[model samples]
Target chain A: MKRYNVGIVGATGLVGRKILEILVERDFPIQNLFLFASSRSHGKVITCGPYSVSVEGLNDDSFKDKHLDFVLFSAGKEASHHYAPLAAEAGAIVVDNSSCWRMDPDVPLVVAEVNPEDAFKHQGIIANPNCSTIQSVLPLKGILDKYGLDRVSYTTYQAVSGAGIKGIEDLKEQKQAHFPHHIHKNILPHIDAFDEDGYTFEEKKMIEETRKILHLPNLKVTATTVRVPIENTHAIAINASLSKPFELNELETVLEAYQGLQIIKPYPTSEMADGQDDVLIGRIRKDPTLPNSVHIWCVADNIRKGAATNTVQIAELFL
Target chain B: MKRYNVGIVGATGLVGRKILEILVERDFPIQNLFLFASSRSHGKVITCGPYSVSVEGLNDDSFKDKHLDFVLFSAGKEASHHYAPLAAEAGAIVVDNSSCWRMDPDVPLVVAEVNPEDAFKHQGIIANPNCSTIQSVLPLKGILDKYGLDRVSYTTYQAVSGAGIKGIEDLKEQKQAHFPHHIHKNILPHIDAFDEDGYTFEEKKMIEETRKILHLPNLKVTATTVRVPIENTHAIAINASLSKPFELNELETVLEAYQGLQIIKPYPTSEMADGQDDVLIGRIRKDPTLPNSVHIWCVADNIRKGAATNTVQIAELFL
Candidate 1:
């Protein structure tokens, strides 16, 4: 086994820290570990396994001397937009977790299990799908491959953690910070900024990304993303119209055999998916209303399988 | 104004208590108020604005001599099953809040604004739609009456109070007494008991009752109802494919003009809908995936508009 140099940007944020933890847990072959953060987190010492790294603010030459084999960027879109290209130019394979490069025709938007082959086509950068979209497409790929899909409708119950630390704090402290409204005991239909057509940016990410990942540019996709008060994991109610007719039992079996998708019993809940690495799927049933349509309840830890774990898995594709 | 005797069965339960409060808040014309409860709540004295009534255990003779003009039953199905017919046989019109008689052919299931005229045709017992269903059909009716519905899909974020006091306690104490799974800090895709077809009774209620209330027997309806940890209010994400093409602005205007439906600014959430009598509608947008289809986010106080308030409004139809 050959060890490689690994770097993590935004290392102090929620998803960033999870990335660091996952690297250690998976015992990835890492000869050197580098940590980067914003100016406020500079000089913060973080440890993983036998490695202790101090977070450094990104500079023009930050990645120049690193000889980094892989750089995982969990920073927001603005940071990723500024720093990801610089890191990629510095010769590191940047697996960016922001929405900046996802729809870029040159960049491959990858779900580790669903589209590992797409990772090889990356031009120094691989874009990780949105948290909700990552869990959704795993099952969708199975269905699309077997039955074919005509349309996809997503209604998401996203956890506060999807918004990072401040979102969790808002729920715990009962404050109306981070989120636009009180999220302690309330639900918000708005996730990201709204677009001109009334679909939020979060929804557009799911719609566009799903079509791209599935290699179905014309697949009709719509999403209504909502923020719930849960601390971790996300649950998506996926209603999809299949392109072909099939038995319900056959469809369940097909999903059961799909990689990275778990057919959990008694239906999957947010708590059940928390800390898990796989997309836990349950509540598989026919839509009854539409021809060859089905309803799938998909749950996954938004941080693990959705963000950090998927990023790490993308890096693993390199080895 | 003619005042009449009103009876509230299950007077000590959560919805029952809300019914008592709403009646007082609305200053419902009441010559005398009678309270009935299960054996556990017998002898408890509850006070309304100008009346204080002791809860009595339900007996065959409870409504025989009370001369109750209207009886509102919020007890669970078993209690409502045994007592509702008895009360109706005693010449009192029964408006049940349970699922006992919702699909009964002789019973008219009504949303006050959508189908109040059905109340007049009730043989004896009128049924209140399920909490999730009640909030759902308010907007569905608006859409159906305007553009005609081809297919309907519902995804619900129901509050714990829909399960009554025990559900709220389960969330507060982190107990799993009322629900099959832990609901505090968690989300459950399963609500009520599951039928053989994998749909929960709650989902079935939404599907079957929506068709009944809208008087569209052949309508295509599917639902995925989930229980979130919120204490009050329920929000539903409804996706419908309409028979006729609609201009988005024209559809909004039609929904705005619909009675008992409020086109609220920003998107309606559980917090905004709490204690509100009307179904709050928002996030109206075209479903870009399906032709002539649109998405509507509907929210309402599940206990009020969904249960007690709708029950009271149905009684007011006789006025």
Candidate 2:
């Protein structure tokens, strides 16, 4: 194996830390690992496998002269916008876990299992879709290829951690919240800023990104993104109107075949997906309400399959 | 004002406690209030408007000797089945918050704001629909009447209290759970046992009870019932296809005019409805994915409006 120099931007953050941990777990071919975060996390030491890398602040000089094999961006869109392209321009391929470059025509959105081919189409930078959408699309890919789909509607029960570390802490304490409501014992229907159409930005991502990844430009997608008080794992109740109908056994077979997917009977709960990288799908049933439509339930640990694991898998393709 | 004798069965339980609190809050016309519970809760003193009533154990003679004007039953199915009929036979009209009588042909399923007239048509016992159904129907009634709904689907975020005090304590204490999975920081899609059709009994109740309450006997209704980690309020994301397309403003106006329904713009969250009697509706928008369909977000305090308040309001109708 050829060891390559790797960098994890925003290393002190939640998703960033997960990416580091996963990189170590997978024993990636890394000659030297670099950790970058906002100035506040400077000098913070994070241990990854045999390497103890001290987090450094990202600046104009950080990506200027350094040549790296790959860099994973888990910072917010603002930071990703500022530094991801810099790393990509500076001889390193960037796998961004932000909404910054997701919809950009030049940046290919890649889900390792679902659309690995799209990774090759990337112009130095690849986008990882929203956690909710990533878990949802993995199971839908094989079925979408054979059965085809007309309309898909998602009602997401997202965890507080999807907002990142601050959100996780908000639930642990009672005083403040990253969410509008007190999230300890409540739910917030708003995920992101509301658009004029009344659909949220988070919802729009699930709709648009699902279509882009599936290579279905004309797919009709709608979503309601809600934040539940759970600490991890986002659950979605999906209703998809198919273009064709097949045996129930066939649908189960397709979903169960996903490498990181589990088809548990009765229904998938958030707890079952915690700390696991696999996306769990259950409560599979034919939607009697709509012709050619089915009700599917899917759950995934927002940090693992939704974020860190996906970026690491995308990087593995390069090795 | 007519002061009538009121009896609250299962007074020590979650919903029963809420019923007691609400009866005092609303200052209902109660000449005498009698409390009844299981053997374990007997001798507990509950203070009301002007009297402290000690809850007594239910026995064969509990309902046989008393000439009660009205009885509200929140005890389990078996208890309600045993004692409700006895109270009804002894000349008291019963409003039962149990599934045992909900689907009975003689029992009219009532949501006070939606179907007060159905309360009058009761053959001895009026059934309070499931907590989820009760909150959902309050907002749909006016819209269903004017627009004529085709298919309505509910995805519920039910609170722990929906399962009674044990479920609430399970979340609070981090101890034993009524659910198979830990209820704290998790979600359970299985609410009640699964029927042969793969739908949960809670989902079935929303489907059947909504159809019955709206008097749209053949209305297409489907539901995905999930128990979220919230302590109060069952929030639902409802998609209803209208038989006729009307102005969105007119739809909002009708929903806002419903007596106990409040149409909060942007979206209604679970925290906003806690301890309140009104069913909060928001996030009202047209769903382009489902033709002639509108997306609705509604939240109501499951113990208050979903159970106790609805039962109390039903009693107010007879007052």
Candidate 3:
């Protein structure tokens, strides 16, 4: 097997750690692997397969002379904005897991199953879609392939971890910071900051990312993003209005055939996706009043398929 | 002040307890008060204001000769089905909080804020609509009265208390049963058992109860109900297509004018309705794609505004 020097940025973060664990579990060929975190996490040691590497403090010199094949960035947007370019300019293919460059005309925003080929066309950087957006659009791509979507409305029950480690701790300790309310026994309709149009930044990202990934620049979509107390997975209740008429059986058949989409019966619950890699799609039915429309319930592990697994899948496109 | 003899069944359950608290808090005139519960909770004592009452064991004979002026039944369907009729036959006006009598033609499913007049036409029995339905319809009545409904759909983020005390305890202790999955950190799409048509019993109840409460017998409606881990209160994301195009300003004006609906802006959160008597409505915006359509987010104390508050209000209609 061929080998490559791979680097993981923001490695002490939740999604970052998952990336390390998954790379070992999936046996990705690696000759030399590097893990980078903020100065606060510098002394930590993380192990992957047979390799044990001490986390290094990420700064201007971290990627200066290291000839790396791929670097997966999971830090927040600011850190990625500051450091991702350095790794990319240093001749390393950077796969960023933030919203910073996702909408940049040149950065290819990819969900592996839906747009694997797009990852290969990336110019130095490839962006991963938002956690909720990734789970929703993964199954939606199959439907989109069959019939162009006319309008989509999403009500997302996103897990706490989608906000990263502090989000997980907040739920554990009954604290609130990035979220507007106590999330332990509550749900926050506000995710990200509110845009002037009353849509949260999180909602905006899902709407725009879905349109971009499906190659439907003109698709009408609106989303209400909410933060639920769940720790690992995110779920969405989606109503999609399709441009063409679709039979109930045809909707089921397309989802069943779609790679990385699991259509479970009696509906899909968030717990069912806690550690699962495939996005669970179920509760598939037709909207009573809308012609050519269907409703779907979807769930996936926010850290795995929504982030880590997808980041790794994008890296696999090169091999 | 006029007073009446009142008997409350299922006194130890969640909604039943809330009913007792509200009656005392609001100082509803009571000539005499009686508390009844199942055999297991029969001997328990509960306090209301300055009154202490022992729970009487409920049986076939409990309401046979009580001659009560009013009876509030919050027991499960079986108990309500067996005892509510007996109470009504004994000359007590029965206000049932179960699904048993909600769809009965002669029985009025009343939300005081929406249809207080309908309570008077009840043939000795009145029904409180499902907690989810009551909150949704309260604000919707303002719109329905102005412009007839074309089509409606609801996606609910219901708290565990909607499932009763055991459901609340399940989330509190991280236990699972009744709910398909663990409820501590997850969302269950299956609220009630499923019917052959794939809709949960809870979902069907919301659809039917809304039509009955709104007096829109032929209303086009559908619902997807999910259980979140919150301890109290339920939130809904509603999308309604109106019969005619509505000015956003006029829609807001009607909601503002509604008796028990609070039109809060930037969307309503579950925490906002934890102990509130009114249903908090917000996220009022025009649906970008559908003509004559709007999206509104609503939250209410499921135990209070949804059940106990409405049940007591029905009793007050006669007082």
Write candidate 1's Cα lDDT for B183-256 as tens digits.
99888988888999999988998889988999999988899999999999999999889999999999999999
Candidate whose DockQ is highest: 1
Stretches off by above 4 angstroms in model 2 are none
- Which one wins by lDDT: 1 or 2? 1
Candidate lDDT (C-alpha), each: 0.92, 0.88, 0.88
Could you give the candidate ranking by DockQ, starting with the highest? Answer: 1, 2, 3
lDDT of 1 by residue, A195-223 (tens): 99999999999999999999999998999
lDDT of 2 by residue, B215-317 (tens): 8888888899998877778899988899888778889999888898898877777878998998899988888887788989999998988889999888888
* Collision pairs in model 3: none
Ranking by lDDT: 1, 2, 3
TM-score of decoy 3: 0.96
- Model 1 residue runs over 4 Å out of place are none
The parts of candidate 3 lying over 4 Å away from their true place are B247-250
Which of candidates 1 and 3 is the stronger one according to lDDT?
Answer: 1
Q: Per-residue lDDT for B66-85 in model 3, tens only?
A: 66999999998999888998
DockQ for each of the predicted structures, in order? 0.88, 0.79, 0.68
RMSD of 1: 1.1
